[model samples]
Target: MEELLEKLLQAVEFGKVDFKSPYPPQLKGENGAYELTIKALESGVGPQQILENALVPAMDRVGKKFSENKIFVPQMLMSAKAMGASMLQLKPFFTSGEIKTKGTFIIGTVKGDLHDIGKNLVAMMVEGAGWTVIDLGVDVPSARYIEAVNNNPGAIVALSALLTTTMVNMGEIVSDIKANLPTTKVFIGGAPVNNDYCQKIGADFYAPDPQGVVEHLSKLAS
Candidate 1:
């Protein structure tokens, strides 16, 4: 059991999507995350066990590597893709209530920010860490963010803005969420957003990178 889970973990960390994917020359022709995860489930391993023991730990390594500059966005995105392939097999368990997630994370690019690459990366990384992600896409308004938080109680909100101009929208969203959904935690991120900007807007957290976001959410989970 441990050996199989380790395969899944390595597959995720190394960006191995499946047997046919050949991007990682060293892992060529090996069963990737998708096949390995399916095998684990078919062998009677618990889905939650696979997630907690395999997927989360693998992403933790990826996150740490990213934070340390050992890897960049492309590598992290590939890892996220590999993790997502495994998640495809595990998702049904979540829907059936056979497994549970850490929590729901609502994320989006604040209004006037059409750039979704950063937001999407954060969404995928956070989702691979076992949270249910609700992506509101680009150019999302404050009203829409409030609606999502209102509908999903206890869900944490993350606001992203790639441009200095759109950054004002993040503050607006944070303000609206804090004013209306007082209990919900609001996290802000972007190139133009710093801890000072986060504090000024009354946001709960400020993570400069995807790993920091994952770490912050991990604390909330505990």
Candidate 2:
């Protein structure tokens, strides 16, 4: 069982989605995350073990590689795809209360920012880390964020903006959330956002990459 978990983790970390996937030549024809996950469960491996021992560790590795410049967006995307393949098998477990998530995360690109790739990447990475992600999509207004938070009380919110011009909206949204909820933690990120801007806006956190957000949330969960 331990060895099977290790193989599943390797498949996820190396971006092997299924047996048909050919990106990693060496893994060709072997059962990938998609197959291995189901097999593990069939073998009586606990869903929580699959999450903690395989998926979580694999995502952590991908995140570290991304943060260190050892991997780029394409590589990270592949890892995320592989993680999703495994997640599909685990979803039923989550729904049935066999696997419990750490918390809920609501994410969006602030109003006026039509960008979504950055936000999507963060959402994927966070979800892979065992948190339930509520994606509000692009061009989300402050009120929408507030409403989502109201619906999922105690949920963490992450705001994304790719353009400097549109990034100004983050400040307003952050202020609104703090004023209304007061206790909700708001994390901000994007190509144009910096730690200084995050501080100025009174946001709780600023992560340059998806992995940084994952790490921050992991700490919070711990």
Candidate 3:
């Protein structure tokens, strides 16, 4: 059972979705994260184990690799895809309360940004690390973020922005979230986003990559 969990972690870290997935040529024709996750559950391995032991650590490693410039967006995206494939089998458990997540994460790109790739990657990373991710999609306005925070009380809100011009929207969104839900934490990311801007906007956290965000959320959970 431990070996199966190790294999699942390898599959996710290397971006192997399943037997049919060919992104990583060396891993072709082998059982992927998706299959191993189901198999572990069938073998009576707890869903939380699959998440905490396999998926969480796998994504954390990938995120560090990305932060260090050892991997690029394509590799990171593949890892996220693999994680998502496995997540499909576990979603029902999470909804049923059979498997508990660390916490809820709400994410989206700020209005006028219209970019989703970065936001999507963070959502996947957070979800892979056993958080319930609610992606509000691209071009999200301040009002929309406030509404989401109200509905998900205590949820951490993450905002993304790719364009220099659109990054300004994050300040307004952060302000609105704090105004409507003072206790909610707001995390910010994107190509143009920086810690300086995060401090300027009064956001709680600023992660340059998905891994840092994962670590922050994990700390909150712990």
Question: What lDDT tens digits, residue by residue, belong to model 3 across residues 165-195?
Answer: 9999899999888887888999999999899
lDDT of 1 by residue, 27-126 (tens): 9989999999999998999999999999989988988888898987788888888998998998899899999999999999999989988889899889
Please report how far candidate 1 places residue 150 from its true position, in Å: 2.3
What TM value does model 2 have?
Answer: 0.94
The candidate maximizing TM-score is 1
- The TM-score-based order of candidates, best leading, equals 1, 2, 3
With a 3 Å backbone cut-off (N, CA, C), the pairs that clash in candidate 3 are none
Q: Model 3, residue 143: what's the lDDT?
A: 89
TM-score of 3: 0.91
Global Cα lDDT for candidate 1: 0.91
- Name model 3 segments beyond 4 Å from true: none
Off by over 4 Å in 1: none
**What's model 1's TM-score?**
0.95
For candidate 1, list the clashing residue pairs, or say none: none
- Measured over all alpha carbons after superposition, the RMSD of each candidate to the real structure, in angstroms, is 1.3, 1.4, 1.8
Candidate 2: what lDDT? 0.92
lDDT ranking of the models: 2, 1, 3
